[model samples]
Target: MLHVNGEAFEVRDAAVGESLLFVLRERLGLMGTKGACEQGECGSCTVLIDEQLVCSCLVLAAGAQRQRITTIEGIATETPTDVQRALVDAGAVQCGFCTPGLVVAAHSLLERSPRPSESEIREELSGNVCRCTGYGRIIDAVQRVAVSRASAREVGL
Candidate 1:
């Protein structure tokens, strides 16, 4: 059984060595987690395990038992979060293969540093690679979100 995306699922036939990535995509049909590289080098399968970011591909399904997992679907919800909107508005997503993991990583960064500078955002998002754009827009997106949050706090939103 797995608790994923705020729901409980019985992954009854999971193999002992099966990864949480496999369980999320193949067994549970949550395709948002891309299996790029499958070696944990790429952050495409990033998910929050007990609020800490980890590569789902590196986590064995059996090891994930009773742990809370939050995927991209879990983050965006019905309405996109500030970071998601900023990324789209800044045209950061090109191939979108790395967006989910990037989003998860960015969310984690913001949780730690609400007003991260450009260098901070870049350093934090370095793990999630994109083959499409040069990451200028991605950096801009995180910056925009950071600025927006700062503004919102001033306005008490």
Candidate 2:
């Protein structure tokens, strides 16, 4: 059994057949996690395993016996999350197919490195692919969030 997003589930007897994406979508009904390029090329199936970004499609549900899993829904704060707000502010969200994964990746990077440089942000989000927005806006969004967080930290707010 594992606890996900503060919910307890019985997976000890669960079938060892499906991928984590299938179990998350089919069994748990956590639709926020997307499935694109099931081969793990795209980060659409990205999720946090102990706060690290991982492709859910490439992971086996049974392997997550006692790990903490955080999906896009779970990572979202009551305040729309800094990355979410920055994406919207920078007009980075388009089509929205990639936003969830992008958000998760950005969240992971921000958590580990609060004030990452532009190159660092790019490296961290390299796993995610977006067909819209030309990536400029997305880059701008990430930078904006990093700047904002840095300012907050400096001001002790």
CA lDDT of each prediction against the hidden true structure: 0.90, 0.87
Reference-based lDDT, residue 75, model 1: 91
* TM-score leader: 1
Runs of candidate 2 with Cα error greater than 4 angstroms are 11-15
Per-model TM-score versus the true fold: 0.96, 0.93
**Per-residue accuracy of model 2 over 1-157 as CA lDDT, tens digit each:** 6567777776544578788888888778889899989998889899988777899999899888689988888988567998999999999997999999999999888888887888898888889999988888998999899899889989999
Using lDDT as the measure, which candidate wins? Answer: 1
Candidate 2: which pairs clash? Answer: none
Q: List clashing residue pairs in candidate 1.
A: none
Candidate 2 backbone clash number: 0
Predicted structure 2, TM vs. truth: 0.93
Cα error, residue 30 of model 2, in Å, equals 0.6
